[model samples]
Target: MTRILRSQGFVTALGALVLALVAAIGYLVVFDPARKTVAYCAVMPDAVGLYPGNHVTALGIPIGTVNSVRPEGTGVRVDFEVQEDRALRGEVTATTVSDTLVADRDLAVLGEPGAAPWDRSTCITKTFTPKSISQTLQGFSQLAGQLTGGGNPGEQTRIRDSVVAFEAATSGTGPELNKLITDLGDALRAPDAAIGRIGGLLDSYSRLMSSIALNWDDIEIVLMQATEGIAFINELWSRVVQLIDSLLVILPWLNSIAREYGRPILGALDGALPGLRLLSANVAGLQQLVSMVPPIVQFFEEVIDPATGRPQLTYAAPKVALPRAEADRICAALNGLRPGHCDGAENGLSDVNLVSLVLGTVGAR
Candidate 1:
């Protein structure tokens, strides 16, 4: 043992062994095959900035690396390995995202854990590559060209001239334009209510239009009738004009005649007005008189002789004489006096007073 320790060759061999063991340990720790990982392949339409050794991330966290990228038909297939703990599964999607405009792209895997884990046999069919900054700028340039009339010089010139003319026309309207913009902003600030009202209005308008469409035939008939009525009116217009002319021609003569006769007619009516009013005042008494006519005719019929058709007259002496005051009251009542006019007597003749008057008159005769 002492001889071996003193041997320089032995010391060199032992140091070499120790170094090899340390290197082996470091290799195992850094790239251990025991750590499980899942291999997956994704076919992307464009893998422009993606290359081998590119990081594969889940939600911006680096989880694996791209193993290879090669063209397959029209698209590029990307082979990657992800840590088994962060294993991607069914319906997984991959996107190449860049940290910045100048930075290399990363493969981002996105999906929730599914029933089946992904293997190399399972190729991710869904993948996206965002538009590059240059491409986006090129597209914007094309849009701007189109807005400015593209390659047509005449159109461009016309648009430019129109813009200039508009600017000239609106030269000093800054305040007005500002006010319009401010008012528009205010009007649109709470747009939900306005949008709801507009929606309701549109719905009502649609219903109205539908109703109008349904009643189109009736509306057409009404329009036709109105057209005919207008034509009829037009046809009568000349007659109306002629009638008006005739009236105009006769108006002076009518005026002259009215001046001559109107006064006398008015005067006569005025002269008779008092008598007419007096007659109207006694209307109730007149009604009472009219009601008495039927009874009078019936009485005359009862007294008439059938053979002669003439009323038969008879006289008899009174059984009892009526007092002068009672006779006066009876006479006043029979003369159609008002109820209160005949004091201590009814407005109508009583049976007793009527009999007494008749008997007394018969006796006097």
Candidate 2:
């Protein structure tokens, strides 16, 4: 029993010395400058689940931990650590995570360490609360109420009813969506039939156009012939028109010459009309007078001097002298005979045969 008591004392002393050495090591660790960090204050809307100890990271690297939390106003003030060796101008972030990588459980971590508040970087000591404690507590209270079937029982019943209705309404959406897709497919296919007909019509039109193109040179020759015919007709019309104009210009002069000649011709015919009429009337009178002149000439032939036995009227041989009484009578008869009548008588008084009588008459006269 004494040996057990001595062994117990020795074991107690060794344990105490081991504890003192650990304490000394912890003090030295706390005071060391290389492992030392700074204390900073962060303002957050809520504390989340930060406790006494949490890890702080600089750009996803663990640098330090959260120290404490205190209420400032409507928000919580957080005390965190940052290594002094690194330059830090902005505060760090604190969040409650389902799995914590901190030395103490359920503590906060620094969101980013290189963030600067005063150096124009977008670093803010702000927080976005996903699930607030107060909100969680309020949800718990509402769940408790609903479970007890007390206070706002009508709202709870309506909510349960609405969930059932929603599930029923959304359940047939799959079939409805399928029908919609079928109608859309029909609509999309409806235009293809018309497009096929259009393509056929266009092909026919192209064939017709090709046929016309194949005959283009013949058509051009026909057109050229028609054009030449039209040009020839136009030229002929121009020449005919010019000839008509020339005839028009000469017509007046021709008419004037005809008029000038026509006046003298008409005047001459007017004068000749009366002369011709008088001449026609006188022709019968002149014909009758010409017939009566022969009878008077025959009476003169009967009265030819009787052959005288005495020399008074002897025309033969101038032989006998005339008796006084007979000579006187014959001389008177000779004086009465007309010279133009005796000479113009066709049967008896030819000058060639009456030369002795013509000489005796001339000597007596």
Candidate 3:
């Protein structure tokens, strides 16, 4: 028994047993039964960041690993293994996508129902390679530089000035930017936000596309009507252009006329209004006064001499003398005084005592 125990062979067997126990423990702890059912898929070898042991995911869940990448035909063949629990089926597409901005990549499998299943024998006919983060950033930088006219020294100065201006404009926006980021985080963390929004957007886009497809004829009719309206607008614009040109030609003469007569015309216009208002106010009385003028003019025209065609005037004395008492009363009445109070009435106011008296004569010139 002592000899058996001291044998190096026994020690080796015991060491092997210890290793077997540890291996069994590890197997129990880490092994997944799902991974035992392996599947293969091919991808282009030149795809960026693709390597063995990179995860394969479907529906954003990790379900497989890249087994090997090797040359196959002119392109590359990527062998990948998927867990049994996550069925690798349908018209699946394995696309390489970045897990982070630092160039880490993974294979994303797109799966659908009612399609063929994939296994070790199945070949992935299509694969997509995404742009690396560095490349994307470089492209953005180039675009920004181009937009700022970056080329030589002068262009660089302009770019620097533009950057400085931009910085100045955005200097006060730190708080707003923080708030924006916080709001964005909250939005992204909301339940089903990204997926639901994308789904709704896709559904709306699909509806829009379908509507356009179905109503193309109506859309065409609308376009035709718009074209006709545009044509009419074009013609109206042409007429307006011609009218403006004609006005331009006449404008200098109109300006000269205005400069010469502007004050006089304005003064006349200002003065005429008051006279017009006065005429309006006395319109009825003036109409009555005007009615008497025609008759008086006609009478004067009849009294004119037929040969000389001139107006005449005459003065005559009374044919018989009034009684002395009657004459005194008539003189008092004519003098507008009491009957016996006229001093001149007693004198010879009618004292042409001769039986016939000569009177003054007036006639046409």
The residue-by-residue lDDT of candidate 3 on 103-178, one tens digit each, is 6578888877656676557688777776666778999999988866776666667766888999999999999999
Model 3 misplacement above 4 A: 6-12, 32-38, 52-55, 58-62, 71-75, 97-106, 110-126, 133-137, 152-365
| Top candidate (TM-score) | 1
Assess the local accuracy of residue 300 in candidate 1 as a C-alpha lDDT between 0 and 100: 84
Question: How high a TM-score does candidate 1 get?
Answer: 0.43
Worst lDDT window (10 residues) for model 3?
356-365
- lDDT on C-alpha atoms for all candidate structures: 0.81, 0.64, 0.74
Better candidate by lDDT, 2 or 3: 3
- Give the candidate number with the greatest lDDT: 1
Candidate 1 regions with alpha-carbon error over 4 angstroms = 1-33, 100-103, 113-120, 157-279, 285-365
* Model 2 C-alpha lDDT versus the unseen true structure: 0.64
Better of 2 and 3 by TM-score: 3
lDDT of 3 at 258: 89
Task: Score candidate 1 by lDDT.
Answer: 0.81
The positional error of residue 360 in candidate 1, measured at the CA in angstroms, is 42
